[model samples]
Target: MANDEAAIKSYLAKYKHRDFTTREVMSLIQVYRSLTYRLEVFVFNNGTRKNLLNLEGTIPVTYKGAVYNIPVCIWLMDTHPQNVPLCFVKPTADMTIRVSKYVDSNGKVYLPYLHEWNPNGSNLMKLVQSMIAAFGELPPVYSKPRNEMPMPYPPTFPTTFPHPQYPSQPGPTFMPHVRPTAEMPTYPNFGLPYPHPGTANGSQFPTPANPLPYPTFNYGSSPEVAGGTITEEHIKVSLLSAVEDKLRRRLNEQSQQSQAELETLRRTAQELQEGKMRLEDILARLQKERSDLDKNITILQEKEKELQSAVERLGEQEGVDVDEAVVTTAPLYTQLMNSFAEEATLEDAIYYMGEALRKEVIDLDTFLKQVRTLARRQFTLRALMQKCRQKAQLAC
Candidate 1:
């Protein structure tokens, strides 16, 4: 049970609506013991293949007054519950699909229940119930007798009719998808009496007064022929034919499954190729950026070496006065530098005399006289510096 639950979880992991889908599926599988779930690739009409969850098994349908199990496969899309599942009838070798309003020639089922499926209301259990009710009304397939001419179905006597209920529950005894004939009667409602339509008045049940006359075949009785009975040889040939038909059907199913898997592999390969191309593109861009960064680092390293060399040379000349280190280009420039120095010295002396006066170290009158004298000499030096600069063709 744990393994089954785990397997179901793994299969439904890819579903878009996993929570509700899992709940519905668990409920369905618990009720229908014959039904099994698998994750397989389902191909669309447009040639798109997707790995979807498939629940395949027989749903018990009450036909006439007897219960028959109808083989069906339900495919849930990735968007299941939100979207209606793809349903189909699977007829075996001994059965042929009966084309009707509910089922098509290809064994695809169609009904108002599926047509008007509501995500909020429609569920797998209810869907199966609807199928049971619908198929009970009009059976989708009829069985064929092996190696014999087709005969009309024997009229079933009305007895305890089986209701459409859970398949796992043992209230109704169900038969396989094998009916003897093509012409089958329809039930007005589930668990109702078998009504013969051909009767003068629609007879609901067979009675001694209105008994249904049906022919019975005795296979045990051998027919006498002029040349010996061919029953043994006929039986052998019939078994061979049945085996061949069963093998052919199995082979066809295997081939289709292989084809779908091949398509899925091809799609996966295509996606992987696309991903590789994108990754290659990103790698190339990263390499180019790395190359650019390397070149920039080399350039910055060269600039750092040049700056370090300049700093080292400056450190060696730390003892030299920066102003005196300037060598005048001509005699007039030399005189201009000297006069500018003297004028700056006089301005400093006058600033100190004003400070002394503020501190009362010198009288205001003494400070004024000293500042006036220094100012007169500073003014003369500044005029001489301007003249020397003009003579040297330098800005004043």
Candidate 2:
């Protein structure tokens, strides 16, 4: 025991200096700083700044004819060489493809080289290289979706050209281009009478005292003024016709929908009447079944009374002598014992049969029929037993 203790202490002391000594951690840190400087790899844990040496870096790997820069990470446990650092290939958010089997959901990489690692033989450099090589089998891609083109502005009422007689001017007084009169226009009650044909508005009544609100007679700058252009008038008419057609179509659709709903309601009313009749029939059937059940209940009560009287008679005749009529039926009751298990008695069979009947394994009719048959046989057997010679040989 003393020798074993000495050996263990020496082994611990040997490892006490630590394989990853101050120099090694510092050297790893230097390597990481240089790599981060060159490759733009960052180090972090849950958004917390951390020592770059421990958990992050990048490795260059080659596949086919191209080379890739794979972001790599290392997790160092306090027990280090006793527990090797876990390495991972960390893909960024842009890597949209399905994860390959070589990597886990957490982005940790797996390779056979890791299993074969020896504390004396392998270092962080060699392990990372192995991961890079394993990753060459399937590579990650940084992809971005192409942007779609934007839509153009919506259409507006066409601008009309000014009449040649009236020269154009800066900011001429006019409302924004009004829709063509082809549409059915809603004019508010101007409170003044409409003008007559030769007059301003179409009303024969005298002009209003307000002079029809300033600029009310304002017109478009279009060369097709009052009635000089025939084509414009026809185009305006066509637009009015189109608007009227749309209004007619909507009204027709509403009427058709109303008709369809009325038809559905009519069918539903008929179905409900038929369903009411069917329910009435079902109710009548249930009433008939209830009456039949009441009759059956009265019959069962009568049988119960007869069973009580027979039980009283059986008690009185327990040891009485019987005659020849019962002797002829004795064999039937003896046959019942054969229906039981080899090691069982007639009492066990009867108990199990009663339990089965109670559990409804046999229906009420079948149970009642069996009981009537057994009762007659049992009574005959009892009578024959009473008549048996007390001197007869007993059977096993």
Candidate 3:
């Protein structure tokens, strides 16, 4: 029902701003119902990191006229939504098998849904649903018998109970030199009546004409593990080969993960470099601004010095006019006025008046009164000049 979608788009968008939590990702896969997930942080050989997720679940699939719960797994990449999650269909019983559709003996699924995964519309829920639908259509063929472990030899013992008819072996004896093989171990039905042990032999035993690879030592009346005897020297070479193959596949997967981590590190380094350049530019601007402020302050200080020098010169030129000094002596005042008419600077007058003032020839109160009277006289002169100018203009 979840399949046959027109487009793939982002679902659970509320979590887009941040990496999805394990719980959130599991829920999207329908964890409680038929899905499960685990989080893993991987550090690669190149000193890069990745937050990976392993997801597995069962889907209701119809396979070879039987409805079965087919197991599946998915590998979520670092940039999950922005990239496609690697999907796999697990073999039913672990025996190597492959199907024409999405199901394969190696648990590799080839499906359009996964191939066309779009970040805008694809989500865990939709992806799983699509997988379930594809798997339902002729999944990898496997038999229930394929699931049963081969019991080449199952150990058995005689019962010793209150019933005297049951016989017990004196001790635990075995054909230790006999080795088990791929052949199925024979087991006699306990319900069947057995012939008396005294005469049953000779027919069941082998002669010296045909030699077996193992020594002949009977554990019980019948040894079913092998045609002959079992030995400790034998090894399960097939099982070991299977294990080695699995290790190689795991190493391959690790290589892919390492490559992905390297890519992420490359992007991170580029961003850091860009940010550092931007900060350097900002720092340069700040330095320029600081230098500009220093120059402005230096110019203001130079202007202040020039203004002070001009004020000192003006004060020297305006030194102690006769009217501004106390009018202590008429001759001194006449001399001061004569000096002013001659355009004499105030510096010389201040020198001469200092001696007069110190000698008490001029009083402090009279000095201040003379300065005020001079200010009033300047104001009256300016007013008369302005009135004459107005009269001249009226005549014109």
Candidate 4:
């Protein structure tokens, strides 16, 4: 498990956001150990080349009670999660690409999930699960005829190892490169109904009963001696080879078991971490609200005490002066308010003078003269009021 994490971290060192992409790839491979990661030059539609990280492997899909490993490669862009990875089916020499609505002739995959990809919601693990489910419904590739042509030698390793020849072009074309040895995962049964064993045909061998054949050694007679006694060296070599093969198979199984257990622990730890963060956030918000509530309660208590003091003071006094109670904040405000009151009084005086003139209490010339003088005084007061309001920043 430590080695796996180290490898993942090393591969993700060149990514823009290493911390996030590392976690994503680690979790993905932990669950699907068959998948291997690599850095390769990805070619764009416009003939641009970029060295990018890609996870390549076969996901098992069950069809008609038999499970088939669907070879696939998912290419991650520099800004992964922000953009959907380019996915394609990678068929082997023994397999043929089966074109369908979901898969194009070039083996490029199209799905609703990829179309509606959300950075926060989508991930490699879910994408792989979706692929498995989709391929199960419609098998992507079928095995070619055995008699048409055969490989010179049977593969010693499982086909889960990614083929080295991934065409650099935009299409999913296979070219030739030397294949590397990779350990086969003793896969846990996953998917709908059928589980992938990560072996050839998902079959198990019993204790290496028929180990790989070794050439018979004859030292005393013709090389074609049929009934010749085998030497101790040959016997020892045969026994060692058989034991080594058995130990290798055991180690592979144990390694996969350990990997599965480690993956489960990692998932649990992640869940606990998330829960801790949620609890911390909730606690912080609650603390802030509590502080605010305490402050409001203190203010209300102070207000109650002030109201009680006022009630007592009013009870003690026979009368309260409303004018004294209402105080202006500034001397300028006091002057402005006094000016408004005088202007209103002058308007009332002018109205009364006009009334007296209408009742013939004074002559027209005297009435006109008194009214003009009063009007001039009132206009002066109105101008002063307008200036005061402007100075006080109040609307006229």
The C-alpha TM-scores of every prediction are 0.40, 0.27, 0.33, 0.40
| Range of the 10 consecutive residues with the lowest summed lDDT in candidate 1 | 160-169
Taken over the whole model, the C-alpha lDDT of each candidate is 0.66, 0.45, 0.47, 0.64
Candidate 1: pairs in clash: none
Best by TM-score: 1
User: Backbone collision count in every prediction?
Assistant: 0, 9, 14, 0
Record all residue pairs in model 4 with backbone atoms less than 3 Å apart, i.e. clashing.
Answer: none
- Compared with the true structure, what per-residue lDDT tens digits does model 4 show for residues 185-256? 121112212213335433232222322111122323324323434356545544564465445446755776
For candidate 2, the 10 contiguous residues with the lowest summed lDDT are 158-167
- Report the lDDT tens digits of candidate 3 across residue range 53-136: 656555555433334455555656555676566565543222223334354323455567766776667777777768767765
Clashes of 3: 14
**Which tens-of-lDDT digit does each residue in 1-396 have in candidate 2?**
345334333433333334453334445544433222111122222232222223454454555534444555565433445445555544433232213444432344545656565666666666765776776766532322223122221244111211111011111121222335532221111122222122432223333343321111111232332333335654554455446544544665577679879999999999999999999999999999999999999999999999999999989874756433344445544443332222244345556678989898998788777767666665665455444433233342
lDDT of 2 at 35: 29
**In model 1, which regions exceed 4 Å deviation?**
148-396
Candidate no. 3 TM-score: 0.33
lDDT of 1: 0.66
lDDT of 1 by residue, 227-305 (tens): 3234674465445644654554467557767987999999999999999999999999999999999999999999999
